[model samples]
Target: MAIKSFQGARKQQSDTSEDAPFKVSDIMCKDLITFKPEQSVEEVIETLINKKISGGPVVNDNNELIGIISEGDCLKQISESRYYNMPMENDNVEKRMVKDVETIDGNMNVFDAANKFLESKRRRFPIVVNGKLVGQISQKDILKAAISLKGHTWDK
Candidate 1:
């Protein structure tokens, strides 16, 4: 009886999912859909919805991420227009894109990335290397890492 209880206690102390190791690049979305700063807000919204993405990075001719545009930002403009009965004309991405964008390094561990996700309201973070956009990581991506790491059982 004591041995059975000891075995059960040992099983309860087994390593949890958080004990596993993974990297940001492990689960980051590589096929990124990006937009240009000069793009009109209308076009931005169209691309975002069509792509089924919540947001994307705004890159320039040099492949540098200048800002990030999201559905939330576009909706704010749209909501305001409806409230004031104004026209949604001449709205550019540069005008609404967030200039102070937060980026993450591709090599960073998933643990730190998860913490960052919990710390901010932003759903996604642009992955950068040498100051150039490479990919994008989202909260879902981190969750993917957690599931993939923990759900796989190693037949030891």
Candidate 2:
């Protein structure tokens, strides 16, 4: 008797299948709470608290992402003010926000984006297109995408 292979037929990756890679744009948050560089740190803090967000992107009137301001940046201001015994005045997002901002492409795969988050230790990434701010992707968004993609083959 001839010995036969026991493995079942494997599923081939298909571009048109539901298992197709999900892009960052598919899950990114389009409605973002952005701030103006000239906005006060106090105002940014207030919006962060009210919106229950850790941080937000600072944009120009043209909606181009210029920087990112976070709770940690605000806390730094607080600590410095206390150290100098000075009031938190004459402070704005531009004065404290991180000007060197890293952005993610909208067409990038979600898994790749997750790897980026892991490597960079970033809580969120701004999605920019043609030098214009479009959306944002967060750790939570990646988690949600993973959960949704469960039971599907993540070949990539």
Candidate 3:
């Protein structure tokens, strides 16, 4: 008599669906905390603390992407204020924000976005479309995406 097997044949691992979303837009946070160039640095600091965010993109009144401001930038202002004995109230987002901003396209692959983070050493990347700030993707977002995609074979 042949030995009986308790387990049945297992199904082969399937590839992720062709339509599966793997782009930055799919994983990025659309409801973003943004700033304005003329906004007071003190206001930015307060919002950053209240929202528990490190930084955000600065936009124009027309909602166009202008620059990025971070906690580090705020700190720089604070430091300068202390060093020069100047009033923090005079500082604004435009003076503190990094104007030469690097943004990511919404359609880029999440994996590619991860590489960009590594290359740029950025904590977050603003997503822009048609010169407007649309959303942001963070290192935390990439980590969340990776964990959510676990157990699946990556296409690349």
Candidate 4:
């Protein structure tokens, strides 16, 4: 049998006719950590620290996304509250969570996802499907993807 040439092999590998366009679902992390609306800020903070996540979507009992909480939101608590003898019960995620949330469909393209992130004030966004929370996409995730794709043929 004749051996295939290196150039022929390279050409075959480069052919992407069957390749699908990149979508948010393809890159988004599906194993999402979510917080409940009734959960205290302290509990949420513990989850964040344990997971090493900047933030996550807050969902109601029905698993519908209600808001998003981030490290920024946590910091807001300290900055806004007075240092007087305040009760731990005074701290709650709902009080500090950004209720006005912006979200994207999982099927969105990476370009559109990145655009939405840039246009919005929120650094993290919840990925939804049919109004249900599925995953989270953050600035860090976008930056990671950008760096991973650097100097690659896909950059063209």
lDDT of 3: 0.91
lDDT of 1 at 156: 14
Model 3: how far is 138 from its true place, Å? 0.7
Q: Write the per-residue lDDT of candidate 4 for residues 26-115, one digit (tens) a residue.
A: 667778888887788878878989989888888888788889888888877766665555655578888878888888777777777888
Model 1 lDDT on a 0 to 1 scale: 0.83
Write model 2 residue lDDT over 1-156, tens digit each, in one string.
999899998887555345544899988999999999999889998999999999999999999999999999999998998899978877889999999999999999998999999999999999999899999999999999888777777755
Query: Model 3, 1-156: lDDT tens per residue?
Result: 899889999768776655445899998999999999999999999999999999999999988989999999999999999999999999999999999998888989999999999999999989888888889999999999888788776774
TM-scores of the candidates in the order shown? 0.80, 0.89, 0.88, 0.75
Alpha-carbon RMSD to native, per candidate: 5.0, 2.4, 4.2, 5.8
> Where in model 1 is the C-alpha error above 4 Å?
1-21, 83-85, 151-156
- TM-score-better candidate, 1 vs 2: 2
Q: Considering lDDT, which of the candidate structures 1 and 2 is the better prediction for this target?
A: 2
Error of 3 at 2 (Å): 22
lDDT agreement with native, every candidate = 0.83, 0.91, 0.91, 0.75
Candidate 4 to truth, TM:
0.75
Pairs with steric clashes in candidate 2: none
- Worst lDDT window (10 residues) for model 1? 4-13
Clashes of 3: 0
Give the poorly placed runs of model 3, Cα more than 4 Å off.
1-15, 18-20
